[model samples]
Target: MGEDRRKEIKYHLSEEKIDELLREAKDDRRKERLGFLKNLYYGDSIAEAADREGRSAATGGRWADAWNEGGLEGLMPSFGGGRPPKLDEDEQEQLVEMLREGQPWKSQEIRHLLKQEFDVEYHPDYLGKFLRELGLSYAKPRPKRPWRPENPEEILEERVDDALDEDDQPHNKRKGDDEEGWIVDDDICTDGGTVLGFFDASQPQPYDNSRRVWYVDDPHVERPLVKTEDSAVGFYAVNGTSVVQWKETEEKEQICEVLEAVREQNPGKRILLVLDKHGSHICEYTRKRAHQLGIDLVFLPSGSPHLNPIEQVWKYLKWTMAPIIVENEDEFHELVKDVFDQVTQRVSFAKSWCEKFLDFQKFP
Candidate 1:
C-alpha cells in the first residue's frame, strides 16, 4: 500500500546478476529465475504492479514491464475484489464450531449447512473467502512426537536379543493379527501368495530377490487391497515383492530345502533371514531348521515394511513387470520367475542396484 514499503521489499540486483537470472529463466527452473528478478525490483510483493504491467498478474513478463515503467508502487496489491465484512463476529464463531465437528466439510459443505439450517446460499468460491476471513486456512496438525529417543536403548536391546535368540525361541514367533490363523497382507495382491528374501554376512546387499525367496501359497483371493470405503486389511509389504504360489502347502519341507540351496551357494556365512512378522514364517519347525542350518531369522517390526531393503527392490521389479500383462497365476508365475531369472543372471546389476539403493536409504 505504501510506496516506501514496496521499495523496501523490491530486489536491487547488479546489472550482471539480473542478466544471469534472466538467462537462467530460460532453463527449466524458470519460475525461480524470474521470481528472483521480480523480488529484486519489487521485493516479490507486486501483484498490482504486475497486473498493471500485464493483463494477467501471473506472468513474470508483466512484472518486468512494471519494473521498466513506474517503480515499486506499480507492484503492490490494490483493493480490487470488493467491500468486506458482511459476516459479523457471531457467524465467524459458528463457522469455527462447524469446522471442529464436520466430517470432511469444505466451504461448499458449510454453504449447504447454512442453506439447510438457516436457508442461505453462498457460491463455493465465496465460501473459501469466508473461511479464509475466519482464519481457517490450510494448516498441518502439530506433530505429536516431534522428538523421540534417537536410539531407544531398551527397544534396541530387545531387538538385538530377539536377533540373537533366533535359534532359541525364534525371532517374533508371536501370533499376529490372524484370529483364524490367517495372516493377510493388505490387498492389491495379484497372486494369492507371499515371497521372502534374505540377507547374510557374505551378501552385503540385504535383499536381492534373485537370491532366494520363501514363496508360499495364500488362500485369501478376495484381493488384499486398500479401498477408500474399506479399512486396508493387508500388510503393505514395502521392500518385498508380490505374493506367489511358488511353493505349495505340501512343500514346507521343500521350502526349507530351497533356503538350504541358498545357503549352499553362500557357504560358511552367518545367515540373516529378513522377513515380515507373518504367522507362517514364524513356526517351531522353521525355527528348528534355521537353527540347525546356522541361519539367524530376523523379524521386521509390525507396520514397518520400509525397513526391508528387498521391499523397495521388489517395487522396482513390479514397476518393470507392470507392462508384461499376466492374466492368471501360471502366467504370473512365469513372468515373475522370468524377472527373477533376469535379476539372477545379472549378479552385478542386482548387487549394484541394491547397494546404490541401500546407500540412498540405508538399513540395519
Candidate 2:
C-alpha cells in the first residue's frame, strides 16, 4: 500500500498540466498561481515545497497546516516586509548605463565609487547580488587609458561592427582543426595591362564537417580587416576588396578599367560580383559595365566586411607589406604584385574561393 502511494505521488502532476503552466505563466501573477497550483495538485511534501521556496520546512509545513486549520486564509503570505533592495534605483540605473557602454568596472569599483561619492559601502557579496539584480556581471576587459582622447570614430565603428563582429573571428565557417590552412589572393586587373596583387594565408578545414556545429559556440578565425574604412572616400566590395583609390588620379580610372576587364574575362560565367556599396564603385559606368558583362553585382550591407574573403586578403597583404618602404606608386605596385604572386601559389586561396561559393549557394 505504501509503495502504491509513492507510485501515485511520482505521477501526480500530469505532463499537460506542466506544459500548460509553462505556457500560461507569461507574467508574475500567473507564475504565482502556477506555483500554488503545482503545490496543490501535485501534493508535494512540505519539505519539498520548503526546498522550492528556499524556506524552512516549518514555514512550508505551516502553510498546509494553516489551510487544514483555517482553510484558504492560511495560504496568503503574512504582511511581512519583502527582501530589501540590494541597490537603490539610482545605483541600478548607473550600473546599467556603465555596463551598456562596455565599461569593465569591477564590483569593487562600484563599491569604491559608492563609498566615495554616496557614502555607501556595501559588502562585496551584496554588491554582486545588486549587480545580478540589474542584469549586470563582473567581466574583465582590455584596459583603457583614463586620459586618452575619446575617438568618436572608434565609438561609431564600435556601434556598427561590435554587434556583428564581436568574436573578432576571421572565418566563422572554418572548422576547429583548420589551422593556418587557407590562402587568399588579391589581383587588380586593369584594362590597360595592369594587375595589382594582394595576398593572405588561408585557414585550414574550411568546410565545417563536424556534426556538432553551432553558430554561437563555434570559434571563428580572426581575419584582420576593418569593417568600415576611416575615410569617407574609399573603395570596398562585398568581400574584403577594399582600397582607398586616389580620387581623380590615373589609378582610379585604372581600377575601374580592371573591373571591366574582370567582366570581359568571364564572358558567360554567371558571375556574382560582391562589392562594398562605396560611391566610386557605384558610379554609372561601373553599373553599365556590370550589366554589359552580365555580372550579378551584389552589394554587401554596410559595415560588414567579414562576409568578404577578398577583404581578408587585403588585410593580410597590408600586414605583410607594411614592413617594405615604398618610394613611389610604381614601387608600391611592384611589391603588391610580388605579394600577389607569392599568395596565388598557395592552395588555400583556391579552397577559400570554393568555400565562399559553397556558403553563398547555401544562404543565397
Candidate 3:
C-alpha cells in the first residue's frame, strides 16, 4: 500500500501554467525542481524524473508533496534562515553617509574603518554581500571641481537674445537691404552662404583600432600590438553635407589652404568658417587671409567643443577608422584619406552632422 501511494503520487498543472511558473521562477534550484515536475507531467516516473534532474527520488517526492499541499509557492527557495547583519541600522547609515561623500575607498580601507570606528569585522569576500544587502554598491569615484557661475540661466538668456539680435541684422544683407533694415527669411541657406562648414584637425595613429571577437571565459581577450611610430594630421571641413576639402599636415599653412579651397569651390558665396580657438585658427595672419578670401572666421566659445559641430565629425571619423590595421606611415596616410573620402561622399550624412548647429540663434 505504501509503494502504491508513492507510485500514484501526482500533481497536475496545465502546460501553459507550468511554463509560466518556470519563467517566473528566479532561482536555479526552483527551476530545476520545476523541470522535474515538467518531466512528470510528460509521463516520466518520479524516480526517472529525479535521475534526469540529478536528484534523489525522495527529494523529488518531497517536492511533489509540497506542490500538492501549497501549489506553485512550494517550489520557491526560502531565504528565511541566514546569519544576522553585523551592522545595526545606525551603523549602516553612517557607512552610507561616508560612501556618499564620493571619496576614493577600497574594500580594505572600508574594512579597516569599520573595525576602528564601529568595532565591526567582516570577511573580505562577505563584505560585498553585506553592502549589497544594505542596498549599497561599489563604484568608481568621479572627481569634480567646484563650479559656481553667477545667475547662469540669466546669462544664457542674455546670450540668446544677443544672437537673435545679430540674426535680425544678417551679416550678408544686400547693401540696400541693410540700409533699409531688411532681413532674409530663409533658414536653409543664410544670405551669407549656402554651405555652412565646421573645421577641425585630428591625428590618426597607426595603433588606434578596435574590433569585436569571441573568446573563452578563463583567458582574457587581447588585441594585436601595432607600431605607433607613424601618424598623420588631417585638416577637414564638413558643411554637414559633404567634405568641402581636407588637407594633410600639422602645419598652420594647411589651415589657410583649406579655407582657400572652400572659397574657390563656392565662388560668389561667403563662407562662414566656424572653428575652435586653436593657435593656428587665431593667428593674425590666418584671420587676415580668411577675410581676404571672403571667409568669415567665427571662433567657438573657449573650452566648449559642444558648440562646434565639427568635433562630432572628427569623433565619427576616428571611431570608424579605429579597426583598420596599418603597417607603415604611408599606409596610415592612405587609410586616413580613404576613410575621409568615404565619409565625404555621403552628402546627406554630412548635412545631418551640421543640423544641430544650423540654428544661428544657438551660436554665442
Candidate 4:
C-alpha cells in the first residue's frame, strides 16, 4: 500500500465544538471527518485517529490541513455540483442483479461492491438515492410461513358462520401440514358459545434482550432487567371484556383455567375461543376441559399466529413494557399485568379480527 500522506497539525477547535458540529451534521462524510477530529482531540495520533475512523492516515492529514485553514467549514466535503451516477443503464442492471442474489446488503457492502466491480465510489446517502432511482427500497420484511393457510379469512369465516356446517354444530377444527396435521374433530361441542374471544400465551422478556432499537439522539441507555420466570396468557374478548394472568408455565391445565376465566366473563353465552394449536393447547386434556367449560376452541391454521387477535395484545404489552425497569421478578410481573390490563381493555384490539372474520349480523 502507498504511504499515508499525513502531517502533525495543530488543533483549531475545542472537543465540545467538534461534538456540536457532529450533532448538526446531516451528511455522513461530515460526521466521519468530525469523528476523525474527535479521536485526534482526545490525544490520539493522526494515524491512530484516521485508523479509528476507518480512513487512511493520508486522508486524516488532509482533513487536519483543511480544519487548520478553514475551521468547521474546512471539514465539510466539497462534492462537485451536478455529478451524475457513474454506472450506465446496462451496468446499473448488472449491479441490481448482483444485489438480487445477496440476501441482505448494507450500504457499506454495496459501496465496496461498487468500488471493486464498477470502479466507482458513492457516499452512503447518495448510494441510497441511486439505489432508489434503480427501483430498490430498504424496508423491514414481514414474515410469511409456507404452511400458513392460503385462505385464512375464508377458514375463519367458515368456522364462525352457523351456515358453514350442515348440522350447524361447532366442530373441533384441524390444519393439515407436512407433519401429522391439526384436524377438525367432527364430534365437538353441540353449541360452543355465542360470545367470541381469542386466547394466546406469550413471554414478555426484558429490555436488555434487544441488540438495537430506535431511540432519541441523547443518552441511549438501558438498565439491566431483573429477569422473570413468568410468561403471560390473555383472553381478548371481542366485545371488550378481557382477562390476563401471569403463568409459571403455559401448560394444558392453564388453558382450562383461561377458558374458565373467559366463561366467567360472559356466563350465559357459549364462548368461542380462537387460538393457535400449541402443544399445551391441542392435546386431549385441554380439549376435554374446554368442552366441559362450554368453550368452543377454534384452532388457527398451523404457522398462522396472525389469525389470533390475542397475539396483537401480547405484542402491544411487550412494546409498552420494553422501556420499563423493574427491580424484582414480582415487580416485573405486576408491571406486565398492569400494562396488559390497560391495553386489552379497549375492545379496539380485536376490531380488525372482527372485521376480517365475522359478519356480526349472522355470527352472533
- Among these predicted structures, which one has the highest TM-score? 4
lDDT of 1: 0.43
lDDT score for residue 148 of model 3: 24
Better of 1 and 4 by lDDT: 4
Q: Model 3: how far is 126 from its true place, Å?
A: 3.2
Against the hidden reference, what TM-scores do the models get? 0.40, 0.37, 0.50, 0.57
* Weakest ten-residue segment in model 2 by summed lDDT: 197-206
CA lDDT, candidate 2, residue 117: 59
Off by over 4 Å in 3: 1-83, 129-194, 207-209, 212-251, 266-274, 291-312, 322-331, 344-364
Worst 10 residues of 4 by lDDT: 176-185
User: What are the per-residue Cα lDDT tens digits for candidate 1 across 1-364?
Assistant: 2332244343445656666756655443343434435454544544453443332233333344444454433422221245544443345456566766764465566777878765667777677765654445555554433333444334433553556332434333444422232221232121322222443111111112233323368522243222121110111122343222244332336445545554444444444456555454556555555555555566555544444555544454555554333345455555555665454332332353344322222133
Q: Who wins the lDDT comparison?
A: 4
lDDT, candidate 4, 1-364, per-residue tens: 1232344556777778789988998877678888988987777777788789876554566567677777777666353345544874458768877887984677889999999999999987688877765556688766778888888778867766743232433244324312222333344332433767788887787664344456679647667646767668888787636787888888888767777677666766667778887998887667766766666778787887877878778877777666666677877878777887788777887787788777766664
Off by over 4 Å in 2: 1-255, 326-328, 344-364
lDDT values for all models: 0.43, 0.43, 0.59, 0.71
**What is candidate 3's lDDT per residue for 79-192, written digit by digit as tens?**
234664577444666776676574567888889988998898999999998765444556786543234243433443343344334443443332433243232212223344
Give Cα distance to truth, residue 6, candidate 2, Å. Answer: 35
Model 3: clashing residue pairs? 209-322, 240-350, 240-351, 241-350, 241-351
Each model's backbone clash number: 23, 20, 5, 6
